[model samples]
Target chain A: MPKSVMHATRAGQPLQPVGRRRFLQVASVATASTALLISGCNKDDDTPSAATVDLGSGDVGVLNYAYALEQLEAAFYAQIIATPYTGISAEEQAYFTSIAKHEAIHRDFFKAAITAAAPGNIIGSLTPDFSSVTFTDRSSVLSTAKTFEDLGVAAYNGAGKLLKNTDYLLLAGKIVSVEARHAAVIRDLINNGDFAADDVVDASTGLDKAMSVDEVLMAAQAFIKEKITATNVGK
Target chain B: MNLFHLISQVEKLDPQAMDQLVSRRNIFTQLAGMSKKAALVAAPLLIGSAFNQVLAGNKDVPAVFNYALLLEYLEEDFYLQALAKPGLIPTGAPMNAIMQIKKHESAHVALLKGALGGAANPRPSSFNFGAAFDNYPTFLAFAQALEDTGVRAYKGKAGEIKEAGNPNDYLTVALQIHSVEARHAAHIRMMRRGAAGGGIMQAGWISNAEANGAPQVVYGPGNPATTFPSEGNTTQAGLNLVTALGTTYTAAEVSEAFDEALDEATVRSIAGPFIVA
Candidate 1:
C-alpha cells in the first residue's frame, strides 16, 4: 500500500467558479482524458504532477477526504468572522459566529479522530484559496458559504458507501445532516425559499445532490492549494 | 408515516399479506448468516428492502425507499392541505418557503411512487391536523417537527442501506433526501424564531430537546437509547464532544454540530398524530 502523503504546494491559480464548472462540463464530456484521474487509482509515479497528495485507501481515505473539506469550510468561516461583511447585522453576525465555531469544531474533531485512529496517516492542514470570495460583501460571503455547505453535504452523502466501518458510517451520517442544516440556512441567507432549491435538490426526485469523490474533488480542488488524490478512497 | 397504521390497513385488505412477506424473508435469512456487526448494521436496510420488494411488488425498490416515500407522503399532504387553506400562512418569505417545501415534498412522493412501481397505490390518509392550519405559528411548529423528524428518520436509515453491502446506490439517494429535509427543517426554524416566549426561539439547527420540550419525543431517543441518542446529546461514539473539543464549545454548540437519528418506531410514534386511518 502507498503511504499517505501531502506534496509541496503549487500556488498562483485563482479560482474562477464559472470557468471551472465549464471546464468540468467539457472534461466530463471528454471522458477519456479525465477517466484515469477520476475513475480509479493512479500511482504517484503514474501521475503527471508530483505535487498531489494521496488521501489513501479505505477508511483513512474517507477520513482525510472529510478532513480536507472541513478544513476548507473552517477556513472560509474563520475569514468571514475575521473580517465581517459590511453592514453585517447583529443576527447575521451571531449566525456567522455560531457557524464558524461549528465548522472549527468539526475540523478539529476530524483531526483528533484521525490522529487517534491512524497516527501519522492524517493529512496535514489544508490551505484554502478564497481569492474568488469577496469576504467584505455579505452577498459574496453568503453565496460562497452556501456553496461550501452544499458541497460538504453532497461529499459526505456520496462517501457513505465508501466506508467499511459502520461506526465511521454512523459518524458521517451524524455530521452530514448538520452540514445540510448549514447549507439550508446559508441558502436562505442568500435568498429566502432557496434552502432546498431545485439547483441542489432535484425537482423530480426531491433529493439533494450527491457527488462522488472525483466530482467533489474536481469542484473542491479549485479552492485548495494542495492537489488531493482520492483514487483509492473507500476502496 | 405510521407503519403500524399502514400495516393494519394492509391487513384489513388482505388477511395473509403479512404471512406472504414473512415467508419470503430473504433479507432475514441473509442477516442470519452474517456476523453480529454486519447483521446489526444491515438488518434495517435488508428488512426494509425486503418489505419494499414484497409490498411494492417492485424487486428493484428497497424498503428504505418506501419508508422515505411514506414520510414524503405525510409531508406533501401536510403542506398541500395547509396551503389550500384560505388565509393560513401569511404572504412573503414564510409563504414562499412553505410553497417551496410543499413542491419538494410532492416531488419526493412522485419519485418514491415511481420507484415503488405498481405497488405505489395510495394508502388511506385521513389526516387530523385540527386547528394547525387555522393559525400560522401552530402550523410552523408542526412543520418544524415534521421536517426535523424527516431529517433524523433519513439519517437513521442511511447507515443501514450503506452497510447492506449492496452495489445499489440507495444510501446516497437516501442521504440526498436527508439533507434536503434538514434544509427544510432549518428554513422552518428560522421562520419560527422568536415566535415562542422565554427566549427559547428555535435555531436553524436543533439545540437540545428544544424549548419547553413540548414534543419531547421528536428530540428524544428511540427504541434503544444507545443506538439513537437525544438531539441534545454531546457524546458521539462514547466520547463527550464538548469536553474533547475543549471549552470553546458549550453543550448546545456541540449538540448543534451533529444531528442524531431516530429509529423507525420512534419516528412513527412522533408522526402518528398527523397520520390517521
Candidate 2:
C-alpha cells in the first residue's frame, strides 16, 4: 500500500487507491500553493476561510463534506457527555447523555468506514468553545441542543443529492433520520409537545429546509477557533 | 489495464471467459430482477448476496437497510406498545389521535417495505426494545433514538431519488412519509414530556407569515425583549408565540445546532454498510 493509503487506514477510512492517488497529488500541490499564496496575501478579512479539505469533485466531495460535519458533531457531544451540565434534571441529563453516546458511536463508525473505502482524507479535529454555553442551566443546554439538532437535519437535506456513491447515499439517509429525531426531542424539550410544528419544517414544501456548505460552515465557525477549509469536497 | 482493453478482451472471449470477465469487472448489463435503474445498481451488490442469508437465517440485513428496517420495526412496535399500555390515550379525542398515528406508522412501514419492493426482506419476529419502555426514562431514550433515525433516513433518501433522475414522484412520496414521520416524532416527544396537548412544532421552518402567523419563538428569560420572558414557559403554545414575537436566536445558532446533529461521520456510520453494498 502507498503511504497515503496507510495514513487513510490508520485514520479508519476505507482505502480507494484511485481516490487516494489523486488526493495525495492534489493535496500536496494545493497545500504548497496555499502556503505560498497566503504569504503574499493580506491576512485581515471578515470572510470565513474556505475548508482545508478539498473534497474532490461531485458526490464524493459531498460525502466527505458530510463526513466533516459529523466529525464536528461527534466531538461536541463527546465533550458534552464527558462533562455533564451542572444542574441537569435526571430526565434531561439522561436524554442528552444518550445523544452524546450515539453521536460518538456515529463519529467513530464514519471514521472507520471512510478509512476503509476512501482512504487518507479524513479532515482534522475541530476545536469548539463552550464558553458561551452555560452548561449548568437546563434552558441553556436544551436550547443549544435544539440548535444543533435542527441544523443537522437541514444540512443533510441540503447535501443529500450531491453524493455520487449509492452506498454513501444510503448511509447518509440512515444518519439523517437519526438527526431528525434529535431535533424533535430537543425542540420538545424547549417547548412542551412542540416537536414537529411549522417552526422547524416548512408547511408549503413540507420538506425540511436545506443549508449550503458555506452557510453551515459559517454558522459553525463561531464555535470553532481554528481556521477550517474543505478540500476535494464537491470538487 | 485501460477500460477499453478490458472491454475488448471480454467481447472477444468465449462465453465462459465472458462470464468470468463480467463477474470480475462487477458490471451488470441488466440487473436480473430490478425495474428501476438505481435499484439495478444496488440490487446486484446488496440483495443478491445478503438477501439469501437474511432469508435463510435470522441474521440482520446489511447496514443501511438493517438500520432502516430496525427503525421501521421500532416505530411499528412503539405504537403497538403505546396503545397496549393504559393511560396513554385518555378519553375520546386523544385516543382518536393516537389511532390515527398508529395507522400512519403502519402505512409508513408498508411504504418503507415498498421501497424495498420484491427485495423486501422478512421482518424479525421480535426486537429488543432495549430499556426504552421499561420506565419513562428508558422510553424517552428509545423514542429519541427512533425519531432521530427516522428524520435522518428520510432526509438521506430524498437525494437518492433525485440523483436517479426518475420523476420526483418517489422522492415526493418519501418526503410526504417523512413529514408524517416528523409529526410522529413530535408527538412522541410530547408524550415523553407527559404533556397534554398536540400539534407541536415540526422540525423545519415555515417561511410564510401571512397564511400562518409569525413563527413561534422561545427565549430564556434573561433578554429584556418581551412580557413574562422570565417565566421559562414550557408549553408548546407559549414557545410558538414567543418565537413569533421576535427572533431571539440568530440564524447561526439555528444552523450550528443543525451542523452538530447532521455531522458527516454520524450519517456515514449509520449508512456506510448500505452504501458500500
Candidate 3:
C-alpha cells in the first residue's frame, strides 16, 4: 500500500479566482512534457515545480480526481465571469455567476472533505490555460462551458462504480446529476434543443456518456496546466 | 442497480445460476428443490439479471425489479402514444427528439424484460397519459413533468441499489439509465424554456426551490405532485446551502447546486394516475 502523498504543491498557494473572494493564489506554467514524480514517496526535494501531480490512490485518489476536475471547473467559470463575454445580458451575468459560485463550492467542498479524510493527500490548486478560450465572446465561453460541463458529467458517471464506500458513491451521485443538469443547460444554450443529443447520449442505449479515467484525463488535459494520472485511481 | 440482492443470492447459488446465464431451465430446476416457503424466500434470488431495483426495497428482490419494469412500461407507452397522435408533437426537432426518447424507452423495456427472463412483470393492464397535447406548447410542458418525474423516480431508488453492493452489475447499468434520465429531464426543460409561455428558460436547471409557477408544469392526471417541492429544497445532509456556501451564491445558485431525491412513496403517487387499474 503506497502512502497518500501530493508531492509538488504543499502550502503552495492553491489556485484562487481573482477579485471578490480572497485567499486564492494563481500559478503560472503550461505545455510541457509531463513528469509524475509520485515516486520517492519518502524523499524530500525542497524545491517544487509544476511538472508533476499524483492524486494518490484508493478513496483519496478518487477524491483527488474529483478535486482536480472541480479545480479546473472553478478556474474555467472564474475566467468566464471575470471578463464578461460580449452580448452578455444582465440575465446571462447572473446565470454565469451562479455557475461560478457552484463550481467554487464544489472545488472547496472536495478540498475540505479530503483534508478531513486524509490531511496531506489533497491535490493542490490547478492552473488554468484558457489561452484559446476567447472570454470576450459568448459563443467561445458557452462552447468551453459545454465541454467542461459534459466532461464533468461523464467523469462522475465513470468514477461512481469504482467507489467502495456507499457514502462516497452517494456524494458522487448527488454531484454528478447536478453536473448532468449543467451539461444539459449549456448544450441548450449552444443549440436550442440538443441538450441530450446523440453525441453525448447513445442513440441505441438511451444512456449518457461515461468515460474511463484515462479518457476523462485525456480530454481534460487541454485546459489543465499540469499533467495528471487518473489511471491508477482506486487501484 | 440493486446488486446486493443479486450478489447475495448468487453467493448462495452462483455456479448454478452462472452455468445458465440466468437460464430459465436451470433456475426452475432449483426452484423445484425448495418447499413452498423456501421457494417464496428464494424468489428474489431467482432474477437472471436486472430486476425491479426500485426504492422502498422489498427483501423480495424480484419485487424491486418489477417496480423498475413498470416504470419503463409507463415511459415507453406514454411516448409511443404521443408520437402516434396527429399534430400532438411538432414535426421537426421536437418530434425527432421525442422519437429518440421513445426508442430509448422501448430499448429499456426490452433490456429489462430480457434480464428478468420469465419473471418479468408485464406492463400494467392500461395506462392513462392525460389529455394528449395536440400542440407543442401543451406537449413540452407535459414532457417536462414526465421526464423530471422519471429522473427523480430513478434517483429515489438508487440508494437501495447502492446498498445492495457488488457483482451488482445491475447498479452500473441502472446508473447509466439514471444519468440519461437526468439528461432527458434537462432536454425537456430546454424545449420548455423556448416555448412561448415557457418562463423556465432563465432557469434551465432544477432549482433548490421549484419555480413559482411550477405547479402547472406537472403532467399525468390525478397524481398530486409531491416530487416538485423537494426539487427546490436547499438543505442537504443537514447543511443549509444558503448559510454554508457563503454570500457570493445567490438563492438560485444554491437551489441549482443539488438536485432533490424522491422517495418511492412519492414516486408511486406520481406514477399512480399514469398506471391504470
For model 3, residues B205-271, the per-residue Cα lDDT tens digits are 6765454333432322222333324555555444565676565566666667766556666667767
Candidate 3 lDDT score at position A40: 28
List the candidate 1 regions with Cα displacement exceeding 4 Å: A1-51, B1-61, B119-121, B194-200, B211-214
Q: How far does residue A121 in candidate 2 sit from its true spot (Å)?
A: 2.1
Specify the highest-lDDT model's number: 1
Please tell me which model should have the higher TM-score, number 1 or number 3: 1
Using lDDT as the yardstick, the better of models 1 and 3 is: 1
* lDDT ranking from best candidate downward: 1, 3, 2
Per-candidate Cα RMSD to the true structure, in Å, reads 9.2, 19.5, 10.3
What's the i-RMS for candidate 3 in angstroms? 2.0
Superposition error at B221 for model 3 (Å): 20
How big is the positional error of residue A81 in model 3, measured in Å on the Cα after superposition? 1.4
> Which 10-residue window of candidate 2 chain B scores lowest in summed lDDT?
B206-215
User: What TM-score goes with each of the models?
Assistant: 0.78, 0.47, 0.74
lDDT of 2 by residue, A1-235 (tens): 1233234435443254423323332233333444443343334433454344454456656755666667677666766676777766776666676566546545545555555566766555555645445555666666667767767767766665456565565556545655776776676666644555566655433345566676666555444555445544554
The candidate scoring highest on DockQ is 1
Q: Whose TM-score is greatest here?
A: 1
Error of 1 at B178 (Å): 0.6
Cα error, candidate 1, residue A143 (Å):
1.7
Q: Candidate 1 falls in which docking quality class?
A: medium
Deviation of model 1 at A52, angstroms: 3.0
